[model samples]
Target: MLRVIGKRLLLLVPTMIGLSILLFAWVRALPGGPAVALLGEKATPEAIERVNELYGFDRPWYEQYFIWAGRLLQGDFGTSIQTSRPVVDEFMRRFPATLELSFLALIIAVGIGVPLGYFAARRYGKVSDHASVILSLVGITIPVFFLAFILKFIFAVKLGWLPSDGRQSPRIDATHPTGFYVWDGIITGEFDAAWNAIVHLILPAVALATIPLAIIVRITRASVLEVQNADFVRTGKGKGVAPRTLRTRFIMRNALLPVVTTIGLQAGLLISGAVLTETVFAFPGIGSFLATAIFQRDFPVLQGFIIFIALAYALINLIVDVSYTLIDPRVRVQ
Candidate 1:
């Protein structure tokens, strides 16, 4: 296991380098670069040239990449052109919100999706199974931004049961070491603040959970159904194994393998998908921050977010790979 992990980590280096090159080229391909974004199209030629030089945009592409890469290696993510804030600092500040939202969404997804899928497969060809199919279809079909608005309207605006947006109510001023507001509230023994943060999180989390919930439901149901007729499962039934033990040991354990993979993929997607959810809810997170960076032509922020998200995706895949052995002993040999 250790050797496998080491190998994967080694592979991450070249993968990241390739991604960086692609990212650098991709950002420049976007319409209206930093110079044009900073200085209007009608601005004087000298003014545009000054902005380009200030941001090293006047240099050759390879030189710009090397300089940026060198700074990144030294833990300097560079400064944002829009806010002039350190890119890394800004990412760090907003990431806690993303983490909070993603986690809540994942929890909701797994809590509902897994059980619903299990029961649906168990009751195949029945009303419950058909309902699950319909629900999952609806979930996948719904656009994120549209869902966010609907949820916000039903739960926040019409019901007034939750806040429309933001991480916390303005009334609470809880503080702690970790940037996670809910975590900070707990550690500081401020129950009210923690509860308030959760309240603020509910709508956005639900909105974010829609797609993943549908996916997990489909994956879990399929995996379970496939495993239900496996030779081992049939053999266990023939041996008069207790129903619960047979299902747990032979059915669920094996079925969970694919579900676990789906979950890891969904978790990585939350970072990218949060953009629409954050924008709709006006939630403060890296997704919305990245969106703002793009419109403002903040190359540093754009590059920093892309690299960070890619690195995160790689790490999540590595973790998922390592977990395969734990999920199924048959995979240990591979």
Candidate 2:
């Protein structure tokens, strides 16, 4: 396991280098430069040229990339053109919000998806199974943004059961020491703030969880069905093993490998998907921050954000790969 982890870490170096190259090229390839975004498009040609030279946009792409990459290696994620603040500072401020949202959404997805899937498989061809299948299909087919709107309208506007936007209600005077409202609220002994934070999270988390929940259900159902027919599972049953033990040990454990992989992939995607969800709910997170950066052509913010996301994805994959050994002893020898 140590050797495998070491190898994966080693591989991340080249992966990041390659990703950096593509990110650099793609951001530069965008139609407008920082100068145009900074100064109005009506700015004089000389003024724009001076702005380009000031930011070294006049330099060759390779030279610019190398300079930026060197700064990155030195732990300086460059200053944002729009905010004139360090990219890392801005990212850290918003990242916890996004992370908190994504974490909750995943919990909801896995909590509901896995059991629904397992039971659907156990009662295959029954009405319950068909209902699960139909629900999963609806989850996959519905667009997240539309669902978000519907949820907001019904729960927030019509029923007034939940807050529609932001992490907590403005009336709640809670201090966010760590940028995570729920945790901050609890540690401060402000239970109302904590509960309110949770209330605000429900609609958006459910909206974000929809697709991942659907995918996990389908994958879990298929994996369980396939594993149930395996020779080992049948052998365990034939040997008069307790039904519960047989299902848990011989069936679900083996089925979890694929399900785990799917989960890891979906978790990474959740970060990306949060952009639309965040926008709909007016949630303050890294996704909405980046969306604004794109329109403003904040190159440093854009570049730094992509690098952060790439590293996050790589680490998630690494963690998932390592977990396989723990889930199934058979994977340990391999």
Candidate 3:
């Protein structure tokens, strides 16, 4: 297991190298250069040249890439062209909110999806099974932005049960020492702040959870159904095991591998890909930050964010791979 882990970790070096090359090339390929994006088109040629030189864009692409790569290796993500702050500092301020929302969404997805799926599998060929299938289909088909708007309109506008946007109520007084409002609120003995944070979180988190929930439901149901027909499951039934015990010990245990993989993939995606949901709900997250970076042609922010996302995916994949051994001992890595 340690060897397998080491191999996976080692592979990340080449993977990151390739990704950095692609990212550098891709950013440069965009239609407008940083100079044009930063200064209006009306800016004089001399002004544009100065801006380019200031950012070292006057250098050859190869030289620029090597300089950026060297700085990255030394733990410098460079300054954001738009914000004029270190990319890492800005990321630290924004990422916690995204992480919190993604974590909640994953919990909701797994918590509801797993049981609903297991129940559907146990009742296969029945009304409940058919209903779950339809529900999953709807969940999968709905666009996140559309659902986010509907949720905000129904819950925040007409019903007034939730805030329409932002991380917390503007009227509330709270300091986020850790940048995670929910945890900061709780730890600081500000129960009202914590509760407000949670209330504000519900709509966006639920909207973000929908697709992952649908995917997990389908994966879980399929896995459970397959496991239920396995030889060991039948043998356990033949041995007069209690129905609940049989399902729990023999069926669900064997059914979990695919479900776990789906959950991990979904979690990684949610952490990095909540742009549409965040935009519709006006939630401040790295997704929205990246979106803004793109439109403004902020190459440093874009490159830094993509690198962060690549690392996040690699780490999540490693965690998922390690979890496989824990979930099913029969599963072995060579």
Q: Which sections of candidate 2 miss by over 4 Å?
A: none
Candidate ranking (lDDT, best to worst): 2, 3, 1
List model 2 lDDT by residue over 208-288, tens digit each.
Answer: 999999999999999999999899988998899999999898899999999999999999989866998999999999898
Q: What is the model-wide C-alpha lDDT for candidate 1?
A: 0.92
Could you tell which candidate, 1 or 3, scores higher by TM-score?
Answer: 1
> What C-alpha RMSD separates each model from the true structure?
1.1, 1.1, 1.2
Lowest summed lDDT window (length 10), candidate 2: 269-278
Model 2 TM-score on a 0 to 1 scale:
0.97
What residue runs in model 1 are displaced by over 4 Å at the alpha carbon?
none
Model 2 clash pairs are: none
Q: List the residue pairs that clash in candidate 1.
A: none
Clash count in backbone of candidate 2: 0
Give one clash count per candidate, in the order shown: 0, 0, 0
lDDT of 3 by residue, 1-334 (tens): 8888999999999999999999999999999878888898788899989999999999999999999999999999999999999999989988998998999999999999999999999999999999999999999999999999999999999999999988999999998899999999999999899999899889999999999999999999999999999998899889999999997889998899999999989989998879988888888989889888988899999999889988998899899989999888788733
